[model samples]
Target: MDKSAAQNSAAFLYPPIDPFDQRMLEVGDGHTIYVEQCGNPAGIPVVVLHGGPGGGCSPAMRRYFDPAQYRVILFDQRGCGRSRPHANVDANTTWHLIRDIELIRTTLDIPRWIVFGGSWGATLALAYAQTHPDRAAYLVLRGVFMGTQTELDWFYGGGAGRFFPDLWARFVELIPEAERTDLVTAYHNRLFSGDMLAENRHARRWCNWENALASIETRSPGGESPSDYARAFARLENHYFANGCFFEQDGFLQSNAHTLADVPGTIVQGRYDMICPPKTAWDLSMVWPRGTLTLVPQAGHALSEPGISAELVRVTNTLRSEAVALGL
Candidate 1:
């Protein structure tokens, strides 16, 4: 599609709406997370999980669902966005996030609700649903990430680098020759180092590497993210990746696909996604039984990509009619 067509298709998002309720919920481990509720209070409940393992929710995320038909819940995971103790990874893990989701659910009195997520968010959604299968009414996932070592290797271990040699070089050039072999660990060391300047410098490089590859339209590495956002995003992401996302084993989500056999889902993937490739989404659909995978041609990985945003909105709009059937 041409630039004009792509810009026009971007209008798929619902009209902007303000949150009717917002607050900070203390989720233990000395952490407090920011949570907000938008749209109809009595409408079907759907929680939005942002990516990065640290990428906090944004107002645009609230625009994906119709305000009159759904209650959208968005929160910043521990140490990111409005969440407290920014950039600190202590006591943060996949399991802690799942517990926080449960806490939010029970606290809101939502017996069951639709789970919407993408990228790392998709990883959490699957883990959360499988752990508490009865709490998920349905799932709307995009850019599937299973948190396996192979997936990690593809992105950080040079598989993706083969395709973007220039960006990969920029990403690795900062580290010493000996440390170039494991960029994640190398970046992890600096990201956590006590020197704020060095941390922020490395953090920007880490984030830029991912951001440049996020969209296919980009001709350059793009601009650096603000130091604060970069620190949180890079640190939390590297922390999770270095630890294998706190999973019991690689392919944990895929091995447990049976748990979601009865939970119907829709996976929206980008045909050219460099961040979370489409193959994982395809692999997921094969075992999910009830899951439907929709690949958006010519799109890359960003949530704002026109094709991706259009399909996600289309999926949510279609699900509105099924709210009653889903026991929303």
Candidate 2:
């Protein structure tokens, strides 16, 4: 299909994710998580976990769930959009976020819901499933970020840095020259300093580099991302980093075999995706005995990529079909 035609497809827009679909639920320690519910109430549950440990939901998120087949639940992690304290760091910690996930699921009374997550969401799904295996029916994960030391090493410690020297340089440039070698530390120090201007600018630079890595070709469908997108993007990353991405091992490619060994999963990866790379998905397939790995040769990490979007819709359909096969 042509670009214009593909742009009109269901993946780009559906019932739509309402950024205003917000709810206030008080997590413990005076922290409240912002939750959003979409799709039909009686449909099979598909809980979505957005990236950024901090990127909140977008209307685009609604495209992942078939309105008639799956009930979608979305929420902003601590210190991110809509959630209270707006960049509040007091009780924001990895353990707190993990606990909050369980709390949200329990509150919704979701029994055996399918976990839909990408990037950091994938990591959270694994961790949540590990701690509560019986609660998770299965997982639909894309762009896995395991938070392993190696993955962190690659992103902050110079793996991704090697390719984006200029961005990396700017990240550390604001800090003292003597403290530049440990880029991640310098970045963390400044990013969490509560300097609004510095944090926002730094976040944009970090996101742009990742955005470039995400698409094999231009991923934007038509116009640029919404203006407030930068603020939303920055909020989540900063929250994730400050909170250790809600994991201790720095999660990517860590030993999750035992965690996901029995859980059925489908990993849809874009071969050309430079952001998370294809190996992450490949590695996941190796781990889950029941994982169905689909490689979109023409696509990359961008959800709107022509082939990738189509395949994801198909994956959702297939999962539903399989559920019928299993009499779920």
Task: Kindly list the per-residue Cα lDDT of model 2 for residues 1-328, writing each as its tens digit.
Answer: 2466446455444556443245899997767777977777777777788877666766777786678777778888877767766656667665677789888888888767788887778777877777777777878777776665556566666666576676556545666888766655666665556777776666665565566556566532223333345555655565565446656454433565666666787787788765677787787777777778888887767666667767767777777766644334
Off by over 4 Å in 1: 1-9
State how far residue 232 of model 1 sits from its true place (Å).
0.4
Report every candidate's CA lDDT.
0.92, 0.68
Compute the lDDT of residue 104 as modeled in candidate 1: 99
Best by TM-score: 1
By lDDT, the best candidate is 1
**Local lDDT at 20 for model 1:** 98
Residue 212 local lDDT, model 2: 56
How far off is residue 308 in model 1, in Å?
Answer: 0.6
Global CA lDDT computed for model 1: 0.92
How well is each residue in 1-328 modelled by candidate 1, as lDDT tens digits? 3476447555888877899999999999999999999999999999999999888999889989999999999999999999999998999999999999999999999999999999999999999999999999999999999999888889998998999999999999999999988888999999999999999999999999888888767746877899999999999999999999999988999999999988999999999999898999999999998999999998888888888889999999999999889888
